[model samples]
Target: MAGEITETGELYSPYVGLVYMFNLIVGTGALTMPKAFATAGWLVSLVLLVFLGFMSFVTTTFVMEAMAAANAQLRWKRMETHKEEDDDDDDSSTASDSDILTPDSYERAEKQPILSVQRRTSPNLFEITDRVEMGQMASMFFNKVGVNLFYFCIIIYLYGDLAIYASAVPFSLMQVTCSTTDNDSCGVETDAKYNDTDLCWGPLRRVDAYHIYLAIFTLLLGPFTFFDVQKTKYLQILTSLMRWIAFAIMIVLALVRIGKGHGEGHPPLADPSGLRNLLGVCVYSFMCQHSLPSLVTPVSSKRYLTRLVFLDYVLILAFYGLLSFTAIFCFRGDSLMDMYTLNFARCDVVGLAAVRLFLGLFPVFTISTNFPIIAVTLRNNWKTLFHREGGTYPWVVDRVVFPTITLVPPVLVAFCTHDLESLVGITGAYAGTGIQFVIPAFLVYHCRKDTQVTFGYGTVNKHRSPFHHTFWVGFVLLWAFSCFFFVTANIVLSETKL
Candidate 1:
C-alpha cells in the first residue's frame, strides 16, 4: 500500500486516517462553541450544529471526489505524453511495454490501465493515489479569476485563524497566571470582573500582561515560519492525546457539577438572534475539508470512504453535543468564557488546583503546537500567490519578507482586540464560507465535467461522492449564498442594536 500511493508520506489504515480527520476538525472552534451554544440557546445550537455538520460532510465528500478526479486528470495527461513519445519513436512497442500498468495496492490492482491506448477508460485512473492540495486543485479546475479569488479567500481565512491562535494562547495564559486567589479559595465564584484596567502584578494591568505573553509567544513560535517545519508524527500523537484528555476532563467536571444540585444554568429554549454566530461556530468546528487531501490520500483502502466519513461526522456531532450540553447545564450563559476551559478555573466546578491549572493552560499547549504549522502554511500560500512562471525569489525575499508579512498582520490584529468570539464568527462566516462551501462545489462540478470529457461518461470514479447529482452542486452553492446573506444581516442588526 505504501508503494502504491505516490505521496512521500507513509500509508496508514483508514482508521488512522479517521483519527487525523477528527483531530483536524476539532480545534479552537470547539472550545468557543459552548459560549455560542449558551447564547444561542441549547435547542437552536443543537439543530444548527447537526445541520451544519451534515452540510460540512457533504462538502467533504465533494473534496474527496475532486481529489480522485485530480489524480485521474494527472494520470490521463501523463498517458497522453507517453503516447506522443511512443508515436515519435521507431521502438514505440518497447516504450509502451515499459509503461504497462502494474498491480497497485488498492482493491483494483487486478484492473487494466485506464490510460492505455487500447483502452482510454479505467476506474483505476481515478483512484486517489496522489496527494493534491486544495490550492493545486483550484489551479487545475478554476480559471484565472477563479483561482485568484480562491487564493484570496483562503489567505483571509488563514489570517483569521492565526489571529485566533495569537490571542487565544496569551488570553489563556493571562487568565491562569494573573489570578489573585489562592489555590484553596479559587473555587469560590465572585462578581469581580477582570477587565483590562484591573491590576495583575502591582502596577501592571491585565491587558499589559496579555501583551507581554503575546510577545513571548511570537518570539518563541514565529521563527519556525522562516524555515520549513512540519508537525512530526510523534508530536501529532502527543498533542492529540493532550487534546482528548483536556476535553474529557472538562466534560467529566461539567457532568459532576450538574449531577450535584449546584448547577447554576437555566438557559432559554431558543434564541434566534444568536443564530448567526452559532452558524459560524458550527462551520468552523467542522472544518476538515481544507486538510482532507493530506489525511485521505494515504489511506490504504478507500472502498468504503464515504461510509467512513459519515461515521466520523456522526461521532464528532455526538461528542460536540455532549460537551456543549454538559457545559450549558453546568454553568450560566453569562458566565461562560470564550475559552471554555477557563470556566472550570474560576468556578467551584473543580476543587483541585492541578486540574484547574491544567484546564486553563490546555489551550496554550495545544494551540502552540498548531501555531507554527498554520503560520508556515500561510507563508507558503503568499509565495504561491505572487509566483511567476520560471521566476526565482531572492534568499532574503523568500526567507525573510514572506514570513514577516504573514506574521505581522495577525499579531497587530491580536494587539488591538482579543475578542476571540467575534474573530471566530467573522472568520468562519466569510472566508471559511468560501473554503468550506464555495470552492468544493465548483471543484467537484468542474472536475466532473473534465473527467467526462477525458474519460467519457462511462468511466466511473470509485470514490465519487454519494451526492453525485448535478443538483447537489447547485444546492451547495445556494446554501453558501444564503449563509452570506444571513450572516450579513445578523451583523447589521447587531450593530444597530449597539
Candidate 2:
C-alpha cells in the first residue's frame, strides 16, 4: 500500500482545480476569437464552437482517464519492485502469488476468480495521485516514433505560443503608442489609418516602434529562459484578476454599445469561407487537455471531478458565446481587429480614455506574465528532446544553448509577421489537433489496454472517463483526421486564390 502511493504536489479542492483549468484554457486565444467569430458569421461560429467545446471536453476526460491509468501502472511497477526486494531478503519457498501478479499471471487470475489479493489496506489501484505531464504520458503509451512526434508537435505549438505573445505585446504597444496626429494622447477617433511606414515619433515609424518594443520585451523578460519561473500564488491571483477585469470590461462595453443601438456590426448568417480559421480559433480556445494531468491530479477529492469539469466547460462555453456574440454585434465584421481588445481602443466604441488605454495594454500585461514561464518550458523541452540517459551537458550548452534556441526562433517568427489570427489558427489547427485530439485518443486507448493487462480487467479506475467506450476513442481520432484534412484543403485553396 505504501509503495502504491506517490506524492504529486500541493493538493487543493476540486473547485480550485476547475479555476486553474479555466484560466489555462482561456488565454490569448479567447482574445483572438471575436474577430474570427465575426468573420465566420454567428450561426456557423455558434454551431462549430459548441461542437468543438464538446469534443475538447471529451478529450479532457480521456486525459483524466489516462492519468489514472498511468498512476496505476507506476504504482504497480513500484509494488513489484518492492516485492522483489522482499523476496530477495526472505527467499521464502511459499511466496504469495496474489501479492506479485505479473501480466501473464494476472490474465490467468482473471480466469480463476477464487484467488484474492491480500493486503493491509485494499487501496484503489487506479486512483490518480501523481501528476503525469503529457510528455510523460506520451513516453508511457506511445512508441518511440510517436513519442518523438509528440515532443515535436508540442515544441512547434510552444513556438507558436511564444511568437504570438512576442508579436502581440509589441503590436499592442504599437497600436497604443503610434499616431497620425501630433498630440501625445493620440486622438482615438482619428480617421486616418496608420501603417508600418507611418511615422510614430518624428523619425521613428510605427514598424520601428513595434520592433523597439519587441526588443525591449525580449530584454525585459527573455532572461527567465536561463533561469526558472515559479509562478507564486499572488502572481496567479494578480494575473487572474487582470484577465477577468479585461474580459468583463470588453464584454460590458460591447453590450453597452449594442444596447444603445450605436452598434455598427451586421455579421452574416453563414460564411463557409471563414470556417477554416474559425475551427482553429475554437480549437485553440478550448485547449486545456495537454496540461490536464498537472491541473487535475492535484485535486484533493475527485468524487465529482467529471461534474466539476463539465460545469467548467459549460461556464466557458457561455462566456465564449457572450464575448464573441457581443463583439460581432457591436463591431463591424470587416472592421474587427485581430486582437479584439484593439477594437475597444477606438474612441467611437469606448469613450473612456482610461478604459481604452487599459484594454490596449491588457495583452501586454497578461502576456508578459506568461512569456517567461513559456520560454522556460520550451527551453526544458528542448533539453529533454536531445537528452540522453547517463549523459551530462556542459554548463554553456545546458544553460546557454537551450535557452537561446528556445528564445530566438519565436522572436524571429514574430519579426516576420505579427498576424495573431494566423498564428493562433495554424498553431491550434495542426499542433493543437495533435495535442487536443489525436494524442488523448491514443493515450486513453493504449492506457486502457495496458491497465487491463497489468491490473486485470476486474480493477476499476475510479477516474475513468464517462466516454470509456472504445467507440468514443475511435470517434475522436476520426474527427481529428477529418478536421486536419479539411483545414489543409482550405489552406491550399485559399493560398491558390491568393
Candidate 3:
C-alpha cells in the first residue's frame, strides 16, 4: 500500500503527512500552558488535561482518516471522468473518418495513418491535461488552503487569549513585589546583589505595551502566513526547538521557585480550601488542551501516535504537579498568575531584570508561532470566496486587506480592555471549550465505523451501537451547553461586582 501508485503514476510522501501532526500541537499552546494550570488547580486541571489529550487524539485521528477517505473518493471520480472523456474522443475521431470510404480509401488510410493517429490523440490529450490541471488546483485549494484557514482561526483565538493573559505578568509581578518606601516607589529594595534597573517606569512600560501589541499584530497576521508553510520549513524547525528550550526553562524555574518555598501566595479569601484553590489555579494554568490536537494528528508508526500522546501528557502532568506543589510550598501566601510566579515577585534585582527580559521577549516567540495559523485561515477563505486557486491573486486585497479586516476588531478589544483574567477567562470559556471538548466529541461520533467496535476500536464512530450514538449526541449537547454557560458566566463576571 505504501508503494502503490495512482493510475496517473504519481508518488506520495507519507513523511510530510506525519510532520503536520507535530506542527499543530507544538505551535501556540506551549507558551500559555503554565497559565492554564495556574488558573484551574492541580488535581482537577491535571485530570482534565489528560482527558482533553485523549479526546484530542481520538478526534484528530478520526478527522485525518475521514479527510483521507474523502480525497480518495474525489480521486476516483476524476479518474473515471478522464477515462470517459478518452473513449468519447476516440469515437468522435473514428466517426469523422467513416464518411469518405472508397476503393482507394485503404491505400489513403495506410499512407495517412500517422496523421490519423495524431488527430485521434491530440484532443484527448488536451482534455486530459486540462482535467489534470484542474484537479491539481482543486487539491491545493482544499488541502493546503481550506484546512489551513480553519487552523488559522483556532490559533488566532488561542494566541489572542494567551497574549491578554501573558501581558498581565509584568504588572501582576510589580503589584506583588514592589516597595513603597523609597523614591523608587515601584522598585523592590533587596539585599541580594545585582544592578537593579527600575521597570516601574521609563521604557519598560513601553516595552510591555510593545510586546502586547506585537502579539495582537501577529495573531492578526496569522491567516495570511499559511502560504509560507511550504517555504518556511527551516524556520519552523528552529522555532520548534526554541519553544522546547523555553519549556525546559519554565520547568526549571517552577522547580527552583517551589524548592525555595515560594509557590503559594496569599490564600483565597472566599474559598476556605485556599490550598485547593491555589492548586487548582496552578493546574488550570498548566493544563493545555490545545497541544493534544498536535500530539494525536500524526502517527509516525502504527500505534506510535497514541503512545506519544500518552507520554507527552504524562510528562506534562508530572511537570504541572511538581510545579504546583513547589509553588504552593514556597510562596504560601503570594502565588500569582503562573507557576514561575515568583520570577515576577523576587526581591533580587538581577532576578527581576531577568524576569523583565524574559517577559519582554516572550511575546515575540508567541507572535511568530501564531502567524501561520492566521494566514492559513485567510488564504482558505479567500480561495472559497473567489473560487480560484489560493495565492492566484497578486493584489493587496488577497494578502494585506483580508488579514487587516479580520484582525482589527480583536486588536481593538485587546487595547480597550487589556485585562488578562477577563481575556483568558473568555477564551477558555468559549473558544477553548469548543476546540478542546466539543469538536473532538463530534468528530469521534462522526468517524467511527461498525466493524471496528468489537475490538474497542470504534469509539469514535460507534455506528454499530445506537447506545454509543445517543451517548455521543448527549455528550456533544452537554459540551455545547457548558460552553454557552461558561461564556455567559465570563461575561457576567466581567460586568458585575461579584
Candidate 4:
C-alpha cells in the first residue's frame, strides 16, 4: 500500500521503473530518425542525433531535480498542516475560520499547496498533464485562426520539407526496382509501342501543401487524446510497439544498404556548402521537442533521470553515427532524399527485396503510431474547453479521434503535393524551431526562483543561495537566442528560397 504494486498487489519498485523507461523512448522520433537521415548525409545526421540525445538527458535531469525539490517542499508543508491539526485537537475551544468557510472555500484551502507547487515547478501544461501542448498551438496557428501565425507557418514549412524526404523511401524503391530488373533490351532508347504509361509503377507521392496540412492536423490531434487517459492506454501501447517495430525494420534496411556499397555517387565531404546544408537539415529535424514530456516524468528520481539521460544520449549518438556513416558510404547520389533500401534494391542484392518491403511498411507503421499522439492532444483540448471527465464523454471520441485526426489530413494532402523532402525541410524550419527549442527555455526562465536563508548570528545559522535565479537567467538567454536565430534563419532562408 505504501509503494508500487504489481498485478498480484506485490510491491516492486524496479519493475515500475523499467516500465516507465520503456514508455519514454517509444514514439514518433524513433520512427522518423531513419527518414531524417535521408536528408542530411548519414555522418552529419548521426552527429545531430548524438547532440540531441545529450541535450535530452541534460534537460530531463534538470526537470526531474526541480520536480523532486517541489515534492519535498509539498511533503514538508503537509507535515506542518498535520501538526497544526494535532494542535487544534488539543485545544477544544478553538474554532477557526474553517467553521465559517464554505465547502468550496475549504476545498480551495486544501488545494493551495498543490496549486502552488504546480505553478512553481511546471513550466507548461504539458509538464503537469504529461502531454505536449505546443502541437496544439501549432495546429491552431496553422489550420484554425492563423493569428501570430509565424509559429504555425514555420511548423507547416518544416513538416512539408521533412515529408518530401520521407516520401522518397517509397519512391526510391519503385524507381530502383523498375530501372534495374527488366533488361529485355540493353541500350534501348526508343519509345516502345508497349510502353504503358498507366502501368508505370512509381513511388507513392504527395503534394507539399497537403503534406504540411496533414502534419499540422496530426500534430494537433496527437496530444488531444490524452484527455481520456484511462481508455487510451491500449492505443498508446499498440502505437509504442509499432514504433519500435518500425525502428527495427529501419535498422535492418540500414545494415543491408551499407553491405551493398550504395553511396558510390554521393557528394564529397570536401564540398563544404552541401555539408553545411546537410548539417542544418539534420540539426533542424533531430532537435524535436515533442519527446520532452516523456523524458521528464514526475515519478522518475533525479539521479536515475540524469543517469538514464546520459545513457540514452550515448546510445543514440552511437546508433546515429553508425547509421549515417553507413548510409552515406553506400548511397550513390546527390539527391537529398536517398532511400537507402531502394538504392540497394537497384543492385538486386541479397535480401534487398525484403529490405524494400520493410522500408515500405515502415511508413504505414509510423502513420499508425503518430495517430495516438494526435488523438491524445485533441482529446485533452476538448476536455479543457468543455470541462468534462473521461467517463462523461462517448467512448467513440476517445477511440476514434486520434486515428481520424491523423488519417484525415494526410488523405487530404495526398492530393496537393507529394514532395516529402520539401515538406520536412519546411516543418523543421517553421514548427520544429519553436516547439523544440524556445518554449522550454521560456518555461525554465519564467518559473525560476531565488533561494533565501534566514540566520541569527549568535543563536542560529542559515545560509541561502540564489542558484535558481542565476541558472535560469543564464539558461533562458542562451537557449532563447539560439531558438530565435535558428527559427529566424529558417524562415528567412525558406522565404527567399535560399
Best by lDDT: 1
- Where model 2 places Cα greater than 4 Å from the true spot, the runs are 1-6, 93-123, 181-194
Q: What is the TM-score of each predicted model, taking all chains together?
A: 0.92, 0.92, 0.58, 0.58
Of the two candidates 1 and 4, the one with more favorable TM-score, higher being better, is: 1
lDDT of 2 by residue, 95-202 (tens): 455556544554564455322432321347677887888999989989999889888988988998899999999988888877655343345322224567877788
Better of 2 and 4 by lDDT: 2
Supply every candidate's count of residue pairs whose N, Cα or C atoms clash at under 3 angstroms: 0, 0, 51, 60
List, residue by residue over 389-451, the lDDT tens digit for candidate 4.
454656675457533543445334433544444344445434544444444443333223210
lDDT against the true structure, each candidate: 0.85, 0.84, 0.42, 0.41
lDDT of 3 by residue, 261-294 (tens): 6454432223322222222232224333344323
**How many steric overlaps does candidate 2 have?**
0
By summed lDDT, the worst window of 10 consecutive residues in model 2 runs over 113-122
Q: How accurate is candidate 3 locally (lDDT)?
A: 0.42
Between which residue pairs do clashes occur in model 1? Answer: none
Off by over 4 Å in 4: 1-3, 6-49, 73-265, 270-302, 335-347, 350-355, 382-415, 425-430, 450-480
